[model samples]
Target: METFADLVRALDTNTKTNAKVAALADYFRSASDSDKVWTIAILSHRRPPRPVNTRLLRQWAAELAGIQPWLFEESYHIVGDLAETIALIVPPDPQNETPLGTLSDYLNAFADLKQQSEAQKKAYVFKHWPGMTYYQRFVFTKLFTGGFRIGISQKLMTRALSQATGIDEEILAYRLMGTWDPTSVSFKALVLEPQLEEQYSKPYPFYLAYPLEEAPEKLGPPSQWVMEHKWDGIRAQLIFRKKTLFIWSRGEELVTEQYPEFQVLADVLPEGTVLDGELLPFPGGRVGSFKDLQKRLGRKKVSRRLLDETPVILRAYDVLEWEGADLRNKPFHYRNQILNTLLEQLHDSGQRYPLDGSPALEIANWESAALERERSREKHSEGLMLKRKDAPYRVGRKKGDWWKWKVDPFTIDAVLTYAMRGHGRRTNLFTDYTFALWDENKSGERELVTFAKAYSGLTDAELRQIDAWIKKNTLERFGPVRSVTPHHVFEIAFEGIAFSKRHKSGVATRFPRILRWRKDKSPEEANSLSDLKLLIP
Candidate 1:
């Protein structure tokens, strides 16, 4: 626990990526094998189920610290993080202190927590708190809650592992796929001695594109690039291996059951064919709106009526595997040809298979490409994607080959009506804010109706300025949220808009971000609810 605490401190304090990778690599090289497995599990969001609820932990911590429950509550609001607050308030007991147990020992001990009485659980928790340092306790409590979000990406994790084990990062990434399980298999077999059968269901890391920095024509002649519409749908990989159809989301989830309609692919596609594509809820040939597709998501099982109403199709963009050969190393034009042939097969099938080819954007120059991007809204696509015809598919977000040229987001000026303190270093500052649009009440007075909430796209300096404004203009306090004077106008931008019954304004916006602080405008000058309604299409 002490060593792990040091690792966390090093990781948390360092701002440089190299320093973080070094700290993680050092810990991976030196930590116990069992501890290493647990660390990997926790960092990768694979923690065990929470053994105890938070209310009891707070009560017990307050008693151990000899502080009143209200005092703990006050500190909790100010600190805004339970683990940090308890770690700060808990008193040290040097005389009664003992060496902290290993992480494996703690996890094994927690297995018996459900069987223990409330008093037994309290005693068991209190037994371990006193012996550990504050940071160690913070980590332990956070693990118990199972909400561990550190800054490490899978790419960085693989890089650190590569440094520690003398393995290439790319191979490590493939081994750490959708179906890789650390609990059931040893780390050695998972990374160093991987079995091909075990990895058959796993998805290769997706190759992402950077947003195009300059105009598309800056790259080269139009003949050198292959362009396609960037569909606003789930980025997924469809696998037909071992006579099974597995659809894996980009997040590494095996969501095969979500769209059982995909099962029909096993009838037409040959074994060992893997195609990368966007999953669109398009029946026949016409594509549905994003909202129509979202209804099919978040369901344990799709109803017959819902499935028929919003049938889905895969717009195949690239072919990763064909027959049995791994053609990822082939050029883009070659893989695209392979994808075309598969789509031809799907078309020949008498039954309407849910698969189609994303047509290439035909452009003579960069200026023409810009005009095509503006037409994305007409087709319900987000933007255009440009890929070099000669580049091989690569892992993760490598910057050279592919680029996304997205349309400018739809924007609206709205009034900031409510504010709240955010967690972490910004806990004392009101960074999270709810925005509202102007609506006319029956009384003939302009009213504010909440429509969207945003907390990002502002610099620290800008946040501090708004935080000061919110503190000075607070009209009422409803717990942590403050109803502030609605004077400040912010230009909110979003990818798309949809009519939603859940929202009070009868609408919802996708990927809302503060485009700019419209300091020049007044609350009355903000956009109207009716104006937002027109954007629902």
Candidate 2:
């Protein structure tokens, strides 16, 4: 536990990427194999379930520190993190202290907490708290809460592991994908000596594209690239291997049973076929809105009526594996040709397959591509995807090979109506805000109705200025949140908008952020609910 805590401190304090990788590599080289395995599991967001409730831990810590529960609560609110608050409030007992246990020992004991009584759990926590140092205690509490993070990406970790073990980073990335049991698999078998059969159901690390900032003409001639409409649906992989089928999301979640209509591919698609695609809700052979896809997603059991309403199709874009061989090393144009041919063959067999190749746009140059991007919203797509024809499928987020050029977001001028303290360093400042649109009451009176909440896209100076304004303009306090005088106006930009019965304003916006502080505008000049309704295409 102490060693792991040292690694966490080293990682948290470092701002340079190279320094972080070196620190992680040094730890990987020196730590025990079991500790290395557990560290990798934690960094990859595969930690064990939280052992005890945080409320109980807070109360117990208050008692141990001889402080009142209210004082602890206040400290927690001010600190913005429970783990850090408890670590600071409680002092270590030198006389009764024992050496801290290993990382694996701590996690194994926590995993057994489900069988233990509440008293037993309290005793276990009390037994360990006295021996640890401040940072160790913080890490311990964080692990117990299952919220231990130190800003390590899987790619960085893989690179560090490769440096430590003299193995290729890409191979390590592939081995780390999917739902591997951290407790059961040894580090040697999991990474160094991987078995191909065990990874039959595992997904490949998704290839992500950076947002294209400059004009498309900067990317050179149009003949060297292929353009495909960027669909606004779930990014998924359809894998059929060894007579078994699996659908894995980009987050590495196994969502096979969610859309069982695609399970028929197990028999139809040849063994060892894996296609990367976007899962879309295409009702009546026409692309449905993302809300229609959400209805299918929220269901654990796919009812007949739900299936009939939101029939899904896997719009395959790239082929990763074909005919029991990996084809990721091949050029994308070559792989795309194979993908199109296979889908054509499947369709010609007179079988209704829930698959289709993503169509490529015909363009003479960048100007034509930009014109096509303008029509993305009408086709229910996000924007355009530009892939180099000669590029091979790469792991994680790499630049140069692919780019996502999205359409301009829909914007609205809204009034800031509420504010709240944000987490981490912003805890002392009201950086989070709720924006509202003008709405008409049944009595024909105009009133403010909250339609969106945003906490990002402002400079630090702007945030501090708004924090001061929020403090001076607070009208009412509802726990952590403060109702502010609705005077400030902000232009909120969002990716998409949809009519939602759940929202009070009868609408919801996707990825809404403060585009700019509209100091020139007044609350009376803000956009109305009807204006937002006009945006819900």
lDDT of each: 0.83, 0.89
Per residue, candidate 1 scores C-alpha lDDT tens digits across 1-537 of 777778888988899999999999999899877777777777766765577888898898899999999889778878998888888888767875666877766666676686789988888878777766889888777767667666787668779989999987756766665444444656776667855644576667799999997867678788888789999888999998888888888876567888898898898887788899898988556887788789877576898987888998888899998887888999999999888887887677666788888976556788888888888888889999999888898999999899999999999999999998899888998999899998989998989999999999899999999999888999998767899998999999999998888999999899898989988998889999999998766
Candidate 1: what lDDT? Answer: 0.83
TM-score of 2: 0.84
For every candidate structure, what is the RMSD over all alpha carbons to the true structure, in angstroms?
3.6, 3.8
Looking at model 2, residue 521 earns an lDDT score of 89
Model 2 misplaced regions, further than 4 Å = 29-34, 68-70, 114-120, 163-168, 183-193, 198-210, 215-226, 236-263, 266-274, 283-285, 289-312, 320-337, 364-371, 387-402, 441-444
Clashing pairs in 1: none
Q: Per-residue CA lDDT of candidate 2, range 280-396, in tens?
A: 999998888888898887466899998888999999999999988889999999899999899999889998888988886556888889899999999999999999998999998
Q: Lowest summed-lDDT stretch of 10 residues in model 1? A: 176-185
